[model samples]
Target chain A: MIPVEYMSVILMIVFGFVGMARKFPRELGATVAYTAMLFALAVFGERLGRIVYGLLYRGNPEAAPDLALVQWFVILAFIGAWVVMVYAGQTLSFAGKWPPNAVTGLVFDMLIGLFNGWIVVWTAWQYTHRLGYPQQALGWFVPPLSERASRWVALAPLELIPDGQEPWVLGGFLAFLVFLRVVR
Target chain B: MILSLQHELNKLAFAVLRPVLGGPNPAITPPTGASTGAGVGIDGQVVATAIPMLGADLSAATLVLVGLAAAIGFVRGVRREAITLMVAAAASLIVGWMWPAVASLVNRLWRMFHFAVIERGILAENPMAAWGEAQASAPLLPLGGDAAAWQIGFFVFGLLILGYGATRYVAAPPPKARGIRGFSVLLERVVGAMVGALTGILVSRFVLPRLVPNAQVALLGPGTSLYDRLAPYAPTTILGIVLLLILFGVTGIGGGKPRQKMYQ
Candidate 1:
């Protein structure tokens, strides 16, 4: 039987092609933007839910609902808030007479595409090795130069932070960059 | 050569930006005695070691690059695009953070199916027993339990939010021009092939060696000629190249302009 590890390597290549075929940078940017918006929504929704729940219960544990029920309520709140925020952001971003709209879209799209492509390759790398394939069965497929290139690619972000520091430091810096990019 | 460049860059950066960002410190290193195997460093507590100067240098270089890119975008009046790129970067960070939980959930679900099949006499006898043995051998999360349930719930919720948000906000913008521009088509093919080849090598060298160390897939095995070492990578590299070519062919081409109906 063809080894599963080999199959996974094939799958990774297919994913890479699909990513490029789909216009890697654009799709990648969109994925990242959407994911970030979703995360923001989730965080906002959870906070809102907590506030609402607190008001309803008035800090009384005895009056609180079951754990599952509370969890469900929180999830619902998260979804509701996320939907509202996404729509509002979209409308705001597109409605303006912004000259940079097209350019911004293109640049971001390209950046995301590159990032996503790397992610696809990285995840595939992890899987083929971790999933119990015989040594070198899948590893032999990757070229030497590519391996070095991937490491460098991976290191770009890793180099930004002091070792052992929270990743958010970099995230915050990037956010600042976005703000600068948008404000002008 | 790259390392030296990085070192010089870091020195310059630290001298200039230390007042604002902070003084340069050593980069974090893995605990000295920890094995480089799966589940070795998952726990939050990693014994600290002297940070690599190279890491610091790289960090400085990255900062400079980001600043340069932002400056160029500002000059080009692509403010919106720069903003979008920033947002995308932030979003990537969020996704990266959540990926582990999501992957763990998927693995558990797959294991459940595997277990069920084994129980049904598909693979072996005493499937649960075999599973227990496997679980003990691999340093993975539990297949199913309370923690698993919570993880599944979180994954489902996250997916739902992402799906809804994507449909509403992340729809692909309409293409402006039609048919593949010749230059762009060529560019795509060349870049795609290069990227594909690199990815093939990365998969085999860095990722596989770390995860499946026992597998005899070292890129530069002791005494092996470079040609022999690279022989196995040929198929994967070709596959990558071909896939990229197809991708470029299909997506690079655009529909013709309304006035010109020649290439329909």
Candidate 2:
């Protein structure tokens, strides 16, 4: 039996490849494959947890998780970031009459990604367990901007604030690169 | 702000599903008409953690299978890639649900293969260890009852929406182009394999050990730490990345184009 984490990724790759092989040969196929794998894993995640949980409890299937706000935020963030990155890449790289340099496009998107990272980390800091902790750890500036703003809801509830998942963003950008490489 | 948010949502849907609709080499040319609802933000919460908290059961293999099936239509003279993908997605979803074990088996085999090639020193260090940290910290959902049902329903719905939207909005490529198909296929596999192998080593050597120390338990148990227990497995991980690259590269070349048949 393989370890669960590996199982998850492998599952992703297999489904991803299969999806790619099918009708949607591009990123869409990979996305569906990824989605499918994620769905399957979501279903069996707890069952896999039995590797850890079985020692203590009988591991009833009933004990799973409710979609928490944090979880939702993360999911939305990944999908959002992925989409933004790809679109941005497409717009900058291909939207105009002339195609931009692929390298330039890649760099341009990386900068945008960095900007996004800054914003997410900054936003996350306002509500993190320790307000300035995550920021200081990363060495960034976060002025009150407004003392009154601090008193008010930072933007929304902590859960509601988008947490800017970076991997998905990067994935989108890379997907663009992959797409470009394939099409060009 | 609200408008921007909506726009982002539209983009997210498009970004996430674009790959499914377009294939690796999506047509870059603008669509003939302006498609409505162009949001771009994916719900980060879905895939942030090692485990998908919400709907995300389809494995990479299943994803690939769906793509291949969809591709088969294109190869057979199907013009509407979107519809082909949509059908393939549905078919693959059912197939994946029915044979979860098969998905799991494929995952294991790939991991093993990924570990093998990397261990031989073909690429940077494999990062299977990072997977541990990724898993340890990866997001988890708290869906109490009916994990299967909830996940299945969500998966189907998302795919359907994606299918409908893609078919409706995206345009097909102009005429048959020679060599483009062959070129894109090779590129996708090579890139996928390279990224997989390099990341595998990085995770094992640097990321995993730090984030999720090797031990018998997460906090405290008879053993030291989760990482410690996993230390032995590090070498095995390196091997997997290499093998994964080889396998994907080989398989990619063998895999043909998508079917061109559109909405039949």
Candidate 3:
């Protein structure tokens, strides 16, 4: 229900604390999953959005979904699915020679949590902005975004990655993560 | 490497801030010096396009950079980081609080020493001349050739390193025990890093604001650069980091304890 700008601003710190609590394993798992989701969305989100919108239109003849909004909602669903999977007993759990203690591991975890928070909060912003900052969505009342919130949104992290290069960038990042995992 | 990354980020921030602040876009020509709150540099060239944006960036970046110290500290060892943090905080607070007085004293001493060396030129020729030469080329740094800031930075850090060395060797000398050199040593290093980082943050928090202007602190509010947005997160993030150290230390997990000496 909070404004995306306000929520996104604080989310990273919240995630940092969450990282401290979750330690390494769960946090890394979530990070990997989120990064993968970002990659998948970058690669196929538009195509999938068009397809889904077309199908919904064909099936009901009056669905009338905004394609961008649908895609963002789809992204939200994907995020939700991955969120469940990550928390669902270490589906993408990382394992190996663990760190020396909880605190040391938690440092990395906190960083990872902050990283995830940046992505997740941005996705939330995407959906909310696409919807034109309404006071409600579905049956829930959401807080309205301020006039200046959109300007601040332009400064959020990860949005500056050049367009038409997201797949390659995210793909390379995924590859690097795998390389790091293999080596270390 | 880090500076370059920060530069790229700054460029991006500047692009957004340009329109927001009503500054001339670098891409196109403006109608001749449209008073965009820009400043002229040392070489009589236009320096920052918009000083407030840069100020905000600087404030945010400084805070983030200081927070990064905590990350380094955690990776090293909490205890070591703590000691380092204490030493650094002490040194920086001293330097920041007493800089005016210290600068005057130093100038007086240098004047007296310079006069003495000149008077005793036959005995103190090369050493004094060499020292003078070393002081001459005080190169420019990030905050627009603010050599005073650099001097303060170096002075505080030098004191902390010396303080840390004293604590390590004099206050708590390590016993020469083989095969026990493990995570404890590692923990010591990480703790050192954490302390160093926290100290940097402390300096940034307590001392940096005084050095910067109101415009810089304005970004610390909200609706600014990414760094600015996250600037306020320092307290919670630091709390999380410190609490993790304490919680994990108490739990005795992560092999925090050194491996028992098999050889001994």
Candidate 4:
């Protein structure tokens, strides 16, 4: 069986190549949606998680949400966003101008797709840790992460972004993206 | 001898530019009453260390380089600059992350080469001591100082390959593109310049220093260039710039003639 770390990395690579195959316009829509979702998670994921547990799980003050439930919740959320953006006829689209030409454009498409994949994997990391690594019990992740995976965790987006300004920085970037979109 | 000639050239360039970058201006005289930062003085810090041919701070040169980079970016426009952004970010990030692995790979190859050719082939009669003798005879160049040279070789080779690959994907902009108006054209240059400056900094300040240790000490070491402060936080900076570039893309910054479907 492949280690969880190796599996997730392969998944990311697959998403990148898939994006390359889809080309840029559809990929761009997917990217914007993914990044917007990441921004939402960064800002309100914790509060929303609590709201779900309280409203649906009897609000039992002492009992935490099930790890499987949380994992499924995060997974479903990303899948929902991907569907809405990539397939729902609302993706950011531009066939010709921006990527300049074909070979480089495909590379750019792959990179953006890779970025989205990273966001997905990174979100899983945050949710798992926020609820205390529920995957450890299910044999998805073992105690004492391998050294390479540990390095990967160390480079987690906000964790690596210094000065505790992750939310502000992320929000500002999203706003700018939206502004440019609106202007054009 | 070639290295010495290169050193002489560095000295000659420094001597010519010293009055401009290092020496005080002869144009304006300071009044006697002026404090003039007299205690530290202009030459005090430099003279103390006494390293000639490299005393210039490079702050002025950095600005000029940045300006040149901005001009290059302006010409490239938004699409090309955006593409270059990813390439630059990849180059810097890869250089930062892969050095140890590359160095290790080189070491293993060297060991295999030494065993196969040097030990068994050339000096088979006394193979045991031959490798040791070769290592000891010359401490530089082919003997073993190739470590630093190897690092440079890897850098140049990687850069050339990546650059050559990029050219296939990127081409010159057509002389005039239809349907592009004032704001879009202006925006292209503006964004292009911004992207260009960032890529320039990524290459020169972030990438080059890490690749070449000797240049790092001479140029970006503590108190060497103002860009040194940002170099240490390169990963974080690259992450931010990557996000920003994506944010800038996916919009109407690109306006041009229709594109043909590629690889058909």
Residue A95 displacement (Å), model 4: 6.7
- All candidates' chain B TM-scores are 0.27, 0.20, 0.49, 0.48
Model 1 alpha-carbon drift over 4 Å, by segment: A1-49, A59-63, A67-184, B1-198, B201-264
Residue B31 of model 2, lDDT score = 46
lDDT of 3 at B28: 33
Runs with alpha carbons beyond 4 Å of true place in candidate 2: A1-184, B1-148, B160-185, B188-264
Per-prediction backbone clash count: 15, 136, 17, 0
Give DockQ: model 3.
Answer: 0.04
lDDT of each: 0.38, 0.34, 0.53, 0.56
* lDDT string, candidate 4, A1-184, tens digits: 5655776688789778877876665566566676677667666666665566567657564676574566556555655565555545656754446455553466567877787777666666656555566666666666665766655655455555555576776777667666655655
lDDT-best of 3 and 4:
4
Could you report the DockQ of all the candidates, in the order they appear?
0.06, 0.01, 0.04, 0.16
lDDT by residue for model 3 over A96-134, one digit each (tens)?
A: 434443333444556567766776677556545655543
Q: Write down the worst ten-residue block by lDDT for model 2 chain B.
A: B213-222
lDDT of 2: 0.34
> What DockQ class does candidate 1 belong to?
incorrect
Clashing pairs in 4: none
B1-264 per-residue lDDT for model 2 (tens digits): 333443344345334534543322112232445332233348633332221111211122233433443343333222233233334345445433544544444455555554455343234354666444333441222123223332333444544455433543442331243234554444333433343322223222221122122211112111223335765554345335323332222232222332232121
Q: Which ten residues in a row have the lowest lDDT in candidate 3 chain A?
A: A95-104
The CA lDDT at A109 in model 3 is 55
By lDDT rank, best first, the candidates go 4, 3, 1, 2
